[model samples]
Target: MVSTQLDAHEGSGQNSESEKPTHVETEHAAVTYQEKNAFQAHADESGEGQNTKMTKRRFMALVSQAFLWTGSQIPVYLFGGVPPYIYADIGGHDRWTWFVLANLLSLAAVCPFVGSLSDMFGRRYVALSGASFIVLGMIVCSTAHTMNVFIGGMVLAGVGAGINELTALAATSEMAPTAQRGKYVSILIFTIVPFCPSVLWAQLIAAHSTWRYIGLFCALWAFVGLVLTALFYFPPPRVNSEGLTRGEILKRIDFVGGFLSISGMILFMAGLQWGGYMYSWKSAHVLVPLILGAALVVLFVIWEGFFAPYPMFPRRINQAPRILTLTLIITFISGANFFSILMFWPTQAFNVYGHDPVQVGIRGIPVGFSIMAGACIVLWLLSVFRGANRSLMVISSILMTAGCGAMSVARPDNMSTLWGILVLAGLGIGGIVVPASIITTIICPDDLIATIAALTLSIRVIGGSIGYTIYYNVLVAKFTSAAIHYIGGAMVKYGNITSTEVIGEVIGLTSISLLDEIAEVPGIAGNEALYKIVIQAGQIAYAEAYKWVYYVSIAFGAVSVLASLFLGDIASYITFPKYQHDSQEFERWRGVRMSCEHSLAEIITENN
Candidate 1:
C-alpha cells in the first residue's frame, strides 16, 4: 500500500492524461525520474542486493553512532551551565553571549550543507570529518587563553556537532524498519541517559577543579566516538552519487542555494541575537542584517522552489506536505521551549532557590531525567499504538504548555513547586524531536532522508536562536526595570539612602555579576542591614522578571499544541511494509534468531 502511494505520486505527471501538470510538479517529476534511475543504477552496481538486515556489524555501528550523538550533545549542554566560570577566567563578561552564539550560529548555518554533502558523499567519511572537528575544537577550547580563541573553538565544535547530529540520526533511521523507527531512535536517545546530568557535571568540575577540564573531558569522549565511527560505521554509497564522477558530483551541488541559505541563516540569527542585548532593536546593527538576511532566506526558498536543479530541501517530500510542515513547526517550538529551560533553569536555581553550586546542580537533575523519561515513554508508546503520531504530539505539546504556563507562579520560596514544573516541562521536551524525526523520515524517500532530517535539526536550532533572543530581551528588560524599582525603593525607604545618584550606583550593582559589589558602594559599606535589604529586593525582582519569561513561553508551547492538531494520520505509512524486500529479509533474520534460541533451549533440556 505504501509503495503504491509512492508510485502513484511519482507517476502523476507522466500518466495524467486529463490535464497539464503545474511547473512545480513537472520539475519534481523530472527530479524524481533522475533519482529513480540513479537508485536503480546503484543497486545494479552493488550487485549483492538484500534488504536492510541487522547483522552484528550493523548493530555495533548503530551503537557507535549513538555514542557519537551523546558526545556531541555533551559540549552543547555543558557550555550553557558553565559560562559564568568561563567568562570569569577569560574576562569577556560583556561579550559572554557570543560564547553560545558562536556555536549555535555555526551549527545552524552548516547543517543543511552537511546533509547535502553526506548525501553526495556517504555517511561514514562525512561523519568522521565531523568527529575530527570536535576533537580539534575541544583542544583549542581547553587551552584557550582569550575570549576570541574560545569563541573560535566553539565555532569549530558547532560545525562538528551539526555533522554528527544529522548523520547519526539519518543513519540510524535508515537502518531500522519504519515500524520500529521510533523504538530504535529512542534506544539511541537512551545512550544519553547517563550523560543527561552533563550540566551537573559542568558545575561540579568548574567548582572543584578547573573549568577547562570540562572541554578536555568532552574532547576525550568525542575522540573515542570518532575512533569507533571510523572502525564500525560503513554505510552503503548514496544512490545519487553512485554513478557520478567527482567533478560531476561537485557540479551537481547547488552552491548558489547553499550560499544563500547559510549566509541568510547566519545574518538573520546574528541580528536576532544582537538586538536589544548588544544593540538597540532599531539600530542598523540589528535591522540591516535582520532585513537583508530575511530577504535572502526568502530568495533561497524561491530558488529552491523554482530554479535550483538540486535543492537542499527537495520538492519530492511534499507528498506529505501537511505532516512535514506541521512536524517542523512542532519541532521548532519544542526546541525553543527546551533551550529556554536549558539556558535559564540554572540561573533560576542559583538565584532564587538554591544556595550553592551543588544545590543548583542537584535541582537541575529532575528536569534532565524527566526529559529522557518522557522521550523513552513516547517512543515505547509509538510502537504499541502505531500511527499515534498526531495524538502523541498533541499530548506532548499540551503537557509543555501546562508546565510552562504554571511555572509563572514559581517563587524563590517554593522550591518544591519549581521542581515539579521543571519535570513536567522536561517530559514534553523529550517527546518532540525523536517522534518528529521518525514521522519525517517515514514520509520522505529513502534517498532524501538525510536532507529532510538536516532541515528539521536546522529549524530546531533556528527556533532556539529566535526563542533565546525573545526570552533574553524580555528577561533583561524586565529584570533591569524591576531591579531599579525594588532595590532603589528599598535603599531609600529602609536603608535611608536619599541621594538619587548614590541609590542609582548601588542599584546598578544589583546585576548577576555585580551583586556582591552592592555592599562595597561607599554608603552601603559596613552596613550589613542595608546589604540584606538590597539583596532581598533584588531576589524579589528576579522572581518577578522570570515570571514574565515563563508566561511568554506559554504562548510558544500553545502554538506547538495547535500545530500538532493538524498533522495528518501516518498509521498506514509506518505499519504497512513499505520496502517489501527489506521486510522479507528482516522476517528471515527474526526467524533465524528464534530458531537459534530454540536449539539452545533443547540442548539445555537434554543436559538436564
Candidate 2:
C-alpha cells in the first residue's frame, strides 16, 4: 500500500490531455522530484550524493533564523517589568510565579515538540508560527487584568520562544555557508550580548507609563519581523533536495517524544524554580516531580533509541558530534551559575556593601558591561585562531573558575575594594555562551542539524533546571550551617545575639505601598553600629549560600575542562558541500589515509 501510494505520486505526468502543464516539464515532473526525495535517504548511506545548491534567498532565510533565535529571550525576561506592578487582582508574586511557570513549562512541553516539528516541517514555518504565537502572547500580556488571562499569555509567549529556537540555531546549520557556519552562528547571537535582562530596563520604562506597555512593545517588534520574512527573501532558492516527505515528516514529528521530553523538563524546572522561594529543596513537592521528570527523560532516551524510527536525537547522524558533546557539559554548568549569581549577589550588596535593592541593581552595571565586552573579546579571539574551538573552550572554563572563585570572596560589609572581581565573573559567563553555540551548529549533519540544535538547547534547559534545583538544595543546607557558625562569630565579637540596636539596624523594614516587605537598611552609621549583630547574621546566612554556589561553579568548570579535552578535533560537517562525485571520493580517500596513518603509527611504536 505504501509503495503503491509512493509510486502513484511519482513522476512528472501530464499524461492526461485535460490538464495543462505550466512548467518546462510535464505535470508529474514534480512527482519524479518527490520520488527522488522519498528514497534519497535509502540510496545514500555515506551522505555524499549531490543534493542541491544553496542560494541567496536561503541565506536571507538563515539570517531571519538568527533573528528568531536571539528574540527568544525578549519575552522570557520582559516579564521582569510587568510583574512588579501587578495589581492585587493578580497576586504580587503572581507575575514571578507566571514568569517562572511559562519558562519552565516550555522547557518540558512546547519546546521539545517544536524542535521535533522543525525537523519534520521546515525551519521557516515553525519559526514564523512561533513568532506569531509570541506576538499574540505579548498582546495578551499587554491587556492582562486577571490571573487566568495572564497565565494564558505566558503559555503563548513560551510556545513562540520554543519555536523561535528551532529556526535560529537549527536553521543556521542548514542555511549558512558550509565553511562559515560556525563563525556566522556565533557572531549573530553576539548581537544580544549587551541586552541583559536587568530589572532596571523594565523599571525605567515603567516609571513614565504603565508596565503593561512592555508587553505591547514586544508584540509590535515581533509583528515587524513577521512582516520582514517576505521582504528579505532573496530571488534564488536554497532548498536542499534531501529525502523529506509529508508522511516521513509526520512520523518523525514524534508526538510521544515531544510529550515525554517536555513534561519531564517542565516538571524538573518547576522543582528548581520554586525550590528555595516556595518550599524546601527536600520537600515532596520539589523532589517528587524532579524524580519523576528524571525517569520520564530516561524513558524518552530509550524510546528515541529503541523505538522511534527517526529519533529526536538520532544517534546515527550524531555519532559523537564534538560540538554537541561539549555544549551539553559546558552549558549545564553555565546554566546553573548564570542566574544563581545574579539572584543571590544582591543580598551581598545589601548586607555587605550596605546598598538597597535599587542601589544593588545600580552597582551591578559594571557586571553587565563586562558581560558585553567579554562576548566581543571571545569572538575576536576565536576568529583570530581559525577553528580554535577546543582552545577557546579551555579559556572559557578557566575564566569561569577564576570568576566564581573571586565572587566567593565577596563580603556584605565591604565590596568596594573588590568590585572588579565581580565583573570578572560576568566576563567568564558571557565568554561561555557564544563559543558553545559556534560548535553546536558546525559539527552537526545537515539533515539532523535542527534536531541536534534543538537537543543541545533542550539539554541546556534541562541542566538549567537541575542546576537551579541543586543550587537551592545546597543553599538551604549551607545557609543553615553558616547561620550557626556566623551566630557564634557575631556573639564573640558583640556580646548579644538579638540586641535592640542590632535587630533595628539589620532589618530596614519598609512600609512602601508598592514594595511592602523591601528591606532597605541605609548608611554605615545605623546598620554598622546598631544592627551589626543582625547584619552579621544575615551575612553568615548569605555566605553559606554563596559558598556552595561558588563550589558548584568550580565543579562545573572542572568537569567541563575534562569534557573539553575529549572534544576530539574540530571539523566543519557540511552535509552536501558542493556535492561533486569527485569531492565525495576525495573525502573517502582522506578518511582512509587518516586510518592508515593511525594503524602504522601504532605498529611502528609498539615494534620499537
Candidate 3:
C-alpha cells in the first residue's frame, strides 16, 4: 500500500523521515476521514457510487460557485475598460482615480478578514452574504447621480467581491484532490469565458444604452448568483467551528487584527493613490497616512505572529517558509505586471493606436483569450510534469518579461505586432497567477487554505496598487513633458503659432477626455492642417510616455523571475497515496462524494 503519511516537513517541520505519522492526524485529515465514512454509509444505503461521475447536486454546487466567481470578476474586468464612459456620465474628471481606487482598496482590505470569517463561521452564509452585498452595491451604483455616491457604491461592491472571491477559491479548492487542485481551479476560472469580451461589452453598452446599464446588468447577474448560492453550495461544517458556541465563536475572532489589517490597507493604499496625483508625496496628507498605515500594518503582523490566539496567517505556514515567501513575492510582482497591462493597454490603444471604442475593445480580446489559454496550458504542464512548479514559474516569468520588454517597440506603424505581444504577456499572467495560488495551498495545512489564499490575493492587490501608482506617475510626467515638446514644437514650426500662453491652453486641452476640444481652441479653430499636425504629435508623445511605462515594467518582471528561481520544491506535496480499499467499499463510498472523482480520504487511504 502507498504511504498514507504526508512529508514530515509538512507536518512538524522535521527533516527526519521516521518522524512522519503513519496516518496524519491533522484536523483536516481527521475531518476527511469522518466525511469519508459518512459518504460511504450514505452510498451503501442508496446503492450509488457505481461509476466515477460527479453527482448532480455537487455539479450544481460547482456551477453556483462559478457564477459567484464570474460576478466577482465583472467589476475587475469591466471597470478598467469602461471608466472613461463612467467619468463622462458622472462628471468626475478630476476625481476619476477614486473610482478605481475605491473598489481596489476595499477589496484588498477585506480579504484577510473574509478568510478568517469563512474559516470560523463556515462557507455557505459568508458566500451568500457576499452575493447579497454585490446586489445591493450594484443597485446603488446603477442609481447613483454623483461621483461620490458612485464611489460609495463601489466600496460596498468591493467588500462583497473580496468575500466572494476568497470563498469561491477556498470552496472549490476543498472539493478537489490535492493532486488535481490546480486543474479544478482552472476549470472554475473557465466560467468567466463569457465575460472575456467584457471590456468590449462595457464599451458597446455605453455606446448603445447608458453606462448605468452596466451596473444594472452586474446587479442582475449577482442576484442570480445569490439565489443559486442560497439554494445550493452547501458544504460540511468547518471542523474549527464545530463545537464552539455563538459567544465563544465571537470571542475567538481576532477583531483587533481585523481592524488593523483593514484600516492599514485602506490608509496605505489611499495614501499611495493620492500621492503625486491629488497631493504631493511629501505633503502631510500623504505622509501621515502612509506612515501611520505602515506602522499599523507592522503591528498587525506582530499580533498575528505572536499574540493572536487564532491568527489569520497560522503558524503552520512557517513549515515551508521559503516556498511560501517566494510564492507571495512572485504573486506580488505578477499583480503589478498584470495591472500595468490592464490599466494602460486601453490608453495605448486609444491615444497611440487611434482606435475608436469598438476597435479598442476588439483589440483587447486577445489579452483575455491569451490569459485563459495560458492558465490552461499551465494546468496541463503541471499534470504532465507532475508539478515541476519552480521550473514552470521561472519559464512563465521569463515569458512575461520578454513580452513586457517587447512592448517597448509598440508604435502606430506596427499595430499588427501588438496583438502577438499582448498574447505573450497574457499567457504569462495566467500561468503565474493560478500556480502561485495553488502552491500556497500545497505548502500549508489544509485547514488554513482560506487564510493563506486570502493573504496571497491581498498581497497581489497591494502590489497592483503600488504598481499602478508608479506607472501612472511615470506616464503623466513623461507624457506632459513630451507632449509639450512635440505638440508645442509642431505648432510653432507647422502652424506658425508661437504664443506661449495660447500653446499652453491648446496643449492643456489635449488630454484624452478633451482631445477633440483641441480643435475648438481659439488659435487652432478652422486650421485643419495645424489640427492634424497637433494630433499626430500628441499620438507620438503618448507612444513615448507609454514606452517608458513598459520599460519600467521590465524591471518588475525581472524581479519576478529572480523570485521564481528561489521557490523551494513542492513535488512531494502534490503526490497522493492510492486508495487501498476493495472495489465494493470504493463503490459504496463514491456515491456521496462531492468534491471530485476522489475524496481526500480515498486519495490518502492506507491498507489495514
Candidate 4:
C-alpha cells in the first residue's frame, strides 16, 4: 500500500495537458533532476537545504519553529532582568546567583546529550519531550516557596530548554534553503525582539502581584510550542545508518564519557560560585572541589581519546583547519563578557540610582536593541566585502573594550550616558556570537554540524557560568572594601549609631534596596539628616565597586581582540563552493598519517 501511494504521488499528472510529459523517458529525466538537486541541497550544505519560495505550509512551519526557539531564549532574558524585590519574595540574598548558575550548568550539561538523542530517535520526539519537561519544571517553580526548591526547578527547566534550543536551531537550518540559513536563524532569534517588552511586563506583574505568575507565563509559552510541534513539524528521515538492533544501538552510547564531562564541569563551576561568597578561597570546601573537578575533566579527555568505543568529542574534525576549535575559545570570552553585562548592569542602576524594577527594565531597552543591530551589521558586512569576518571581529572587540571602559566612569547623575555605552556592549556581543556560529557551520563537516553546534552551545554556557561567578565575586569583594572605608566610621560620626558593626551587617546582606533599609535602623530612625548622609555614602561605595567590574570587562574584551588576529581569511567558507569533497578527504588522510607516525615512533623506541 505504501509503495503504491509513493508511485501515485511521483507520477501525478499536471493540471495543464500541454505541459505534462507523456513519454516515460521525459518523466524519468524530470524525476532524476529533482532527486539530484534535493541530494545536493541536503548532503552538501550541512543538511540546510535551500527553499526558494515561501509557500503557505512552509511559512506556517517556520513560524512554529521560530516560536519554539524564542520560547527557549525568553527565560534567560527574563532572569537577566529580574528585579530586586523579586529576590526578597524568593527569600534568599544569593538565590538569584544560584538560580543563574543552575540554569547555565544544566544547559551546558544537557546540550551535548540532546544532540545525540535527536539523532538516535527523531527531532520531533526529542523536541516534544523537551517541551513536556519545561511544562513540568514551570509547575515546580511556580509552587516552590524555598530558594533551594526554586533552583532545583530551574535546573530541570534548563535541561528541557537546552534540548529544545538545539532541536529548534537544527530544524530551522534544515527547513530553509542553504543560502538562507542565516536569515532563518536571525528570524528565530529576533522573535525575542518583540518580547523584550516582557521584561517590563514581568516587573509590573511582580510589583502588583507575585513573581510566580512570570513562571506561569513561560509555561504557557512552552505549551503552545509543544502543540505546534505535534501538529505541523515532522522529523526528516535519516540517510545513513548501518543495520543494528535497538539494544545494540543503545549499548553503543558513550555514557561514561558524557557523565564525566558533565560532572566535572558542574563541580568546577560550583567551586567558582562558592569561593569568596560561601567559603574562603583557601578553604577545603573550595579547594577540594576545584582540584577534583580539574582531575575529572582530564580523565574525561583521556577516556574519550582511548577507551570510549563511541567518543563524544569530534577529535579529527576539530584538529583540521583549527578554526572551529579556536572560535570555541574566542566564543567563551565573548559569552563571559555578554552575560556579565546583562546580569550586572541592572544591579548597578538599582544600587546607584535607586531605580525600581520598572525603571531598570526601561534602562535595559538600549542594550537589547543594540544586540539586534549588531547582527544586522554582520549581514551588511558580508554583502559588501569578500573576507569581512576578520575586520568585523576586530571592530566588535574594539567596541566592547571602549564601551566597558566608558562604563567605569558612569555616575548616577550621568545615567543618560549609559544608553550609548550599552549599545556598544550589545553590538560587540551580538556581532561576535552570530558570526562565530555561521563560520562553524561553514567549516564543519555536513554530518557533524549538529554535534559541533551542541559543542559550541556548551562552550558558551560554561563560559557564561564562569564569567558570572568571577564578576559577582569581584563586585562583592570590591563593594565590601569600599563600603567599609567610606561608610563605616564615616557614618558613625554623623549618624546616631555608635557601632560600625551595624553598617557591616547592612553591606553583608547586599541588595539594591540596601540604603532604603538603613533608614529603618532602630538607632538611626527619625533622623532625616543622618539617613541622607548614609545613603550618599552607600552610593559612592557602589559606584566604586562597579568600576572594578568594568575594568575586568575591558580586559576580557582585549583578550578577544587578540584571539581575532589568529582567525585569518574565512573567505573560502563564505564564497567558495559548498561541499569541497576533495578538501575533506585530504584532511582525513592527513589525520591518518599523523596517527600512524606516532604509533610507529612508540614501537621503534620499545624495540630499541
Ranking 3 against 4 by lDDT, winner: 3
lDDT assessment of candidate 2: 0.53
Q: What is the TM-score ranking, best to worst?
A: 3, 4, 1, 2
Model 1 vs truth, CA RMSD: 8.7
lDDT of 1 by residue, 1-608 (tens): 23433344345633322222222112110122222221222121112242345677668778878877877777868877877778768867656666676787778777767644654566678888888898899999999988889989988998898777766665665555433444565577567777667668888998899899999998998888888888877656544434455566567667898789878877887787778877999999999999999999999999999999877677887768888899999988987887778888877776666446788788878877887677667766765686898999999999888887788887778887777888898888878766776677567754454456567677777787778778877888888888789888898898788888887776555554455677788778999998888888878888888999999998999899999999998876644353445876445434332222221111110000
The model with the greatest TM-score is 3
Backbone collision count in every prediction?
A: 0, 11, 0, 4
For each candidate in turn, the TM-score is: 0.81, 0.67, 0.84, 0.83
Stretches of candidate 1 above 4 Å error?
A: 1-66, 119-122, 169-187, 230-240, 498-509, 517-519, 575-608
What tens-digit string does per-residue lDDT give for candidate 2 at 1-608? Answer: 11221222233232211222111111100112222232122122122343434556555665565556555666655454334455432544422444545563664355445533543454456667877888898888788777668778878877787766544554443333323434545555554544454545554556557777778877876776665554563222212224445564465456787777777776766666556656777899889887988888899889988897655566644655565666678867765565555444543454445434456456655565666666557656654664676777777777877887667766665567557876777777667665564455445433343344455555555565566556655665566556555644564466454454533333322100122232243323333453455455666567656767778778877887777766654543322233236675556434323321221111100000
| lDDT score for candidate 4 against the true structure | 0.65
TM-score of decoy 4: 0.83
Candidate order by lDDT, highest to lowest?
3, 1, 4, 2
Winner of 2 and 4 under TM-score: 4
Question: Root-mean-square deviation of each candidate, in angstroms?
Answer: 8.7, 10.9, 6.7, 11.1
lDDT (10s digit) by residue, model 3, range 34-136: 2233122222212243232467766677777787888887875776777667776776766666666678778877776663365566678889989888889
lDDT of each: 0.70, 0.53, 0.71, 0.65
lDDT of 3 at 418: 86
Q: What C-alpha lDDT does candidate 1 achieve relative to the native structure? A: 0.70
